[model samples]
Target chain A: MKIALPIKFVIICSFLFLIHQIVQAQDNEEKIKMPESNNVCLNCHGHKYFSFYNENTEINERKLMNPYFVIDSISYLQGAHQGHSCIDCHSEDYGVYPHIAELKIEPKLTCVDCHDFEAIATEVKKSVHMEAFGEFFQCELCHDPHSNKLVKSDMAELVRYNNNRCLNCHNDVDKYQVFTSHENPQLLVTHDWLPNQALHFAHVRCIECHTAVTDTADAVHHIVPKEQAVKNCNECHSENSLLRDKLYKHQLKEDRSEFNFYKSFIINDAYIIGANKNYYVNLISLLIFGLTFFGILTHTIFRIIKRK
Target chain B: MSNTKLYLYPVWLRIWHAINALCIILLGITGISMQYTNIESPLINFNSAVSIHNLVGVIIIASYLFFFIAGIISGNVKHYRLLFKGLLNRLFKQGEYYLFGYLKGEPKPFHITKEEKFNPLQKVSYVAAMYVLVPAVIITGVALLFPEMIIEKFYTMSGIRLTTFFHSLAGFFILIFLIIHLYVITIGKHPLKNFKSIVNGYHES
Candidate 1:
């Protein structure tokens, strides 16, 4: 009986150990890399060359029916959805694709479905994008969910990135017409009064001038109309250059060094007239002025002393 | 001392001179401070300086227009004319008087007459200062005010930089001329004679 009881006790302990391991294994499964869970769906959707206008345009005049599904795996993995699984917002039925056509009718998910972005929505309501485009304006219009990073780019990259976002719609006629029937305005022709328009475009973001100056966190989205945009030279070409407050606002701490090619004002490589101040140049001018004044003084003293 | 009064200065001339002097002095003060601004110790705040500079710029342009139109209409510009024949010889003689003879109580180099308002050296310097430097500063100042008119690039430097350099250089030369102009007023007979004439429209000779 003692041997049998000991054997039963050993069996019970072993069973409990097995149960503990099963629970731990289940916990570990949930903790696996979220990207791996998305990999199953990516195998079918992930393609870099898969574009909206593909070779089969002649076959179907209608827009591609499955345009949304073609997510480039490289970009998807790099998106801000590091914590999101495919089923986080999408229906779990999507994970098991090629099975049911009924699954295709599943309602599309929005940013607010998973994220607590009520603040962003509130900001958009007050934005010019919403005011001009009406209720059709959404976050994904400007920010692509497939590949958006947090604010991490440096000043130069940020300029290019922000300007590109503006030009994507502004510089494209078809894209601009998608929102309104108005004829697209030519950028160069309209801005003929602005000097070095091309160079200005490369270094400065459009939002710097187009947007109203707001202390709000979403100041960028609050664009002003054409008449209201900053046109005054003093705004940028002064001692207190608004460039620091606008485009370079991100790098003020790191970029407060002495001016070089970009010195005196607006940019690092360009010399704006009002904002230029070189120590050596000023010193030489002052020395010449002082000597002139001294020589004048000496000449006057001579004329006075010689009047005998 | 010669005690004959001459109507060398007129009312229009006096008014123009007053306004021009005030505007130029203000422009010099504001312009120099702006060019050599020290963030820690600025003579004028940047915004205020630019605003003042612009306002003064407009006033100066108006004064210059008045001077130009009145000088032509009243035949005052004729005084600036110089005879190119023997001009160098006359200039040298006048230069010699100012340099050595004036202090020794020598006779005046060029007598003041209705037709001869300025001496040989005075004609040359006044013409250069009024014609070359004045117009140069005005054109460049307007260009700076409306920077859109300036070309994007010059030969090697930015058009704005070149414009700024020329503007400052011209302004500096004007400032120097002002000092010399004031000093030479003390040259003939009585030092305060010219100052009184500019203010009261009569030069005692």
Candidate 2:
């Protein structure tokens, strides 16, 4: 009886200890802000948001760094990770105070991580840059993934900005013998003598040739390559010039072409003309038919009444 | 078969039907014109035609909403809800009648009642056209009008392509139905009885 009592007591104590350990473990997980493995994070956060961000993938890690701390889940997950786990890049302190900001991580990826950039860079090295600058330029020199915006330049703006800039590079007098600045009084005086055959806007400015704006001030103006600008005849030509001065009569030209081509062309334009013709003919026929029927019915009734 | 005197068409129903029919006719014409824009403009002024087309589209939308509301309030929706009992079998039977028995002068398998005005064939076509085809076309039409909103979430090129195809396919189906509907109108007691009833809001029993 005595031995049985002691054995029962021991068993009870062991059960209590096991319960205590489980409670302690739960508390530990809740209290501390430690960086966990990707698995641990995923268990708490749903897999849907985290699936694409696994750390094993290859993306850029350099541009994603923060200054103070480095627990940034986004940067860590996005950087050089094809199938990486949370623990691969992040310190255990990730869940701690302002870990993401300390890391200064942005989620933009790098091409070198997924692709063989060395091969591409080798080919790029063989280009004119190596000959001009004696060194191959990196991707960051021409393009920044985080900041690259497509710059579209208008024609008028391109002309105004580029004239002086062009002279800086192409200062050879013989190269631009035909081209002179309107700012020069001599050129303006000479320009007045000729009947304005070319439009003022049609004259290509120096800025038309210059694609790059090297300074911060130029970016403020939203300047881009001149070719992207809208081009139409109305941008330059005066209404009076088109109405009378121009030798080419657009309407006359159109009518002449229509006469010659309408019968022979089985194109979309011809079909359009055919449909228009049909519409008019059908409309006129319908009107005549309706009016004739009404007129005849009225006349018959009148005649019948008179005879009666 | 002799329950023609049991029910009368309501004024609102007749007006709704006329408006709906007219809007559909206009939509069909405009949709055809838009598709073949390279062909000459049938309505003389381009801007006027577009404005009229958009106005007609809005009218169709408003009329559909009114129809739905009226159907629910009048307890007329009950006539549309099909009993599932032997539904597939009945559908097949109805299909067979249309395929073969219809040409043989056999009596229609389903009868119209005061409670249910539509026969099985009419029920199926009406249900398919109103619930499926009509809603599909409306959704596509709305998407086309406010493309920016719809494009934000589900903007796959394939999705847009499919929507366009379904819209045109609905047009094709409506064209087929219009021909059949016209023919059916001629099948009444008199050649012009159905047309007169629609216009005058009364049919001679």
Candidate 3:
């Protein structure tokens, strides 16, 4: 009975230890399981030419569907979603071979899922691109999921990036000519009155003129028709130009006292001649002109008849 | 007494004067309209005003060049030259004549001659207006036209702002001069005497 009891105790202890080990193994397996499954999906998709042909093509015809299914692995690794696992976006059950037809996988993940949707939505709502294209305008239209390297803090780069995205569609003059009435073959001719047209074209972004000045955070996005674009030289040439609010927001004085509304005019890298006009000088000149006019008027009144 | 005719303004000077006057009047109207863009003009729209202002500014500059060339070539420049020897004394006398003497029916302090067409005060004012003020206006106007050419900054202001300020100041002085010139023309022996003199290059003294 004593031997049986000891044996029973040993057996119970061994069974408990086995159970504990099994649980520990399961916990470790669960931790690594996600990455393993992700690699399995990447096995087929990671190839440079990984794309499925449309099976329903006629006997003589062949067509490829989802031609860009292959992800540039290097670029994806360095992308904004580098931290995220494939399952995080592809939430559907992609476990089975050839991914079940009934199991609908989201074609594209929404940027709103991770970003500040409200802020983005506010600016996007006012954007002319949205006005023309409608709400279906996906974030992917400008930003590529696998290759996007946009960083908001780097302003000059961000400006160049945004401008390049616009130029992608706009640079095709023949395509643009069909829709807009401004049929000038040379686009720069539209701004012929502006001196140093080449310099302006080289330095200034199209959005600076095409966009309406709005008090909103992203005024550059709120573009207008060419007809509605700002034609006034004073808009940029004056002491309080709209560019100061849009592009040079960083240079704005934090302390109100430090800001001289009259004299505080400067652009970051390049200089705009009229944009830096002074209000105090204008006022002083006006005063002096007024005094001179008054003096002349009084003098003229005193001269009437000749004395002997 | 028989009306004595004095050959005063030459044909080139008269033509220059007429064009300059027209340009100034148009510029003044357009300039004011441009400055106060919100106020609707009866004469022309804002865009038209700006276009006309620019056009008239170019015309005024051209006329100024003509005047300069004509003055130098014709020796009419002598008429505007201030006599430094008795400049202050003559100016005081002319000033007194305009201030009190003219009102009491006194004879004129300075008489017009071929070489000395302007009185001391007239010479001083004309020299300042034509030489200093007009050139300043032209430089500033041209600067405003081609802001890109400007060096971006002057003293405490941008070159554009400084130029614009000076341009407006000069315009104001020119406008005052025009008003005074018109009033003085009416004070001649006959109401239309000076007006006829400008038209036919002869003044009745």
The prediction achieving the highest lDDT against the true structure is 1
Assess every candidate by TM-score.
0.58, 0.40, 0.62
Error of 3 at A260 (Å): 6.8
Model 1 ranges off by over 4 Å: A1-59, A64-269, A278-284
Q: On residues A1-308, what C-alpha lDDT tens digit does candidate 2 reach at each position?
A: 45698888999999999999999998877332234455455433422222223355554232333222223444334333324555443455554432467454643334454556664455445433333444433343333332233322333333333443344224444433323332322334533532221323233442222222223222212223334432322211222122111112222244454442222122111111112122333355457546655654564454446446
Candidate DockQ values, in order, are 0.11, 0.02, 0.08
Best by TM-score: 3
Tens digits of per-residue lDDT for model 3, B1-205: 5667788887888999899889989988887656544422234565577779889999989999999998899988877776599788989999887667766768888887776778888888889889988888888888777867876556644455556667877887777777677766666566688888899998778
Best by DockQ: 1
lDDT of 2 by residue, B88-122 (tens): 89889976765456545567687545676766666
Q: By TM-score, how accurate is candidate 3? A: 0.62
Query: What is the per-residue lDDT of model 1 for residues B119-146, given as tens digits with 9 covering 90 to 100?
Result: 8988998888888888899999998887
Model 1 interface root-mean-square deviation: 4.7
* Superior by lDDT: candidate 2 or candidate 3: 3
**Model 2 per-residue lDDT at B28:** 73
Q: Order the candidates by TM-score, highest first — what do you get? A: 3, 1, 2
